[model samples]
Structures are given as C-alpha cells and as structure tokens.
Target: MAELYFLIYVIVFIVGAVSGLLYSYSIHLEPFVVKEKFNIPILIMAIIGWIFTLNFSLFSMIPSFILISIGVFLIGFVIDMRPGYGRKETIIGMIISILIWLITHCVIL
Candidate 1:
C-alpha cells in the first residue's frame, strides 16, 4: 500500500514537472536552454511534493494543494532571486504543480 502511494506521488510529480516545462515554453522561457539551470529547483520541488504526499489525506486536500503551490512558488521565487537567473520560471512551476494536485485530487476522490 505504501509503495502504491509512493508510485502515485512519483507520477504526480512527473506530470507537474512536465506541465511546468510546457508552461515555461509557452511563456518563451526557452526551457531547453535553461534545463540544466533549473534542475536543482525542480528537484527541490519534487522533494516537497513527496513529503506532502506522505502525509496527504482526502479531508486535507485543500490545505495540501495550497502548501504544494506555495512550495513551488517559493522554489521559483528563490531561484529567480539568485544572481544569475532573472526570469520567474517558478511561477510557471507553481501553476503546473497546482494543476497536478487538482487533477489528482479529483481522480482520487
């Protein structure tokens, strides 16, 4: 059962990352060029998502979504604040994460 939940978490995280990547492209962020640049931040966000899933419960869906969204946003915001990176790719990532959470929430319920 635990393994199944972890697998679901992994799938959700991948979908979120893909969503973020597509969004970045739409916004002209040139994801392919910046792929190496944002790898750490994306990994951090995935870890956050993993932790969230570990404690996730149906009744706490709204709060969980909010937390995950904030986590993604912060990861982006922090990375943007760094010296070299200027664009707000983190916002795009947050959108992807929120979308994933919403979709999975609906499916699970």
Candidate 2:
C-alpha cells in the first residue's frame, strides 16, 4: 500500500512538473517552436530527483519520497512565480509545503 502511494506520488509529480513546464514555455515562446528547450531542465531535475531517490532508498522510502515531492513541487511552483525569491509567494509555498508534509506524514506514517 505504501509503495502504491509512493508510485502515485512520483507519477503525479512528474506529470505535474512536465505539464507545467510545457505550459510555461508555450506561453513564452515567440520566435520558434522547439521541444528541446522544454526538456532542457529534465536533466537537472532528474539529477535532483535521483539524489532524492537515493536518500529515500537509504532511509524510509515513504517519508523521503514525500519530502522529495514537496521539494520538487516547490521548485516548480517557484520557477513559475518566484516573486524575487523572498516574497509572499515563497513564504506561501513554504507554509503550504510544510502543511502538505505534515498531512502526508500523519496519513502515511
């Protein structure tokens, strides 16, 4: 059951991030249409994802997976609208991340 939830979370995170990226690029693209630009961040995000996956592989996969997910979600959210990296959106994301982390912890652990 826990593994199922973890897999679901992974899928949701990837789909959400990819879709968000595509949406963002579509809105910004003006001169040419290239998909490669959309995938450029995949490598970076993959590295970060791999590192988080390693941490999960070492410790509790469930909790670590959730933590990494919250991290990824925040990254995508901030990338969309950082608001100078130290504004209300950052604080909101942090608070929301904590609430999500706590809620998932309580439900899963």
Task: Report the C-alpha lDDT of model 2 over 1-109, residue by residue, as the tens digit.
Answer: 9898778666756665566566656554555443332333433444444344333443464687576675565355334421222233434445554555566566667
Model 2 poorest ten-residue lDDT run: 81-90
After the best TM-score superposition of candidate 1, give how far the Cα of residue 94 lies from its true spot, in angstroms.
13
lDDT of 1 at 98: 67
TM-score of 1: 0.35
RMSD of each: 11.8, 11.8
Query: lDDT of all predictions, in order shown?
Result: 0.49, 0.49
What 10-residue stretch in candidate 1 is worst by lDDT? 77-86
Off by over 4 Å in 1: 29-109
lDDT of 1 by residue, 1-109 (tens): 8677556545555555556655545555543444345546555655454334433453364676555444444443333343334343444444555666677767666
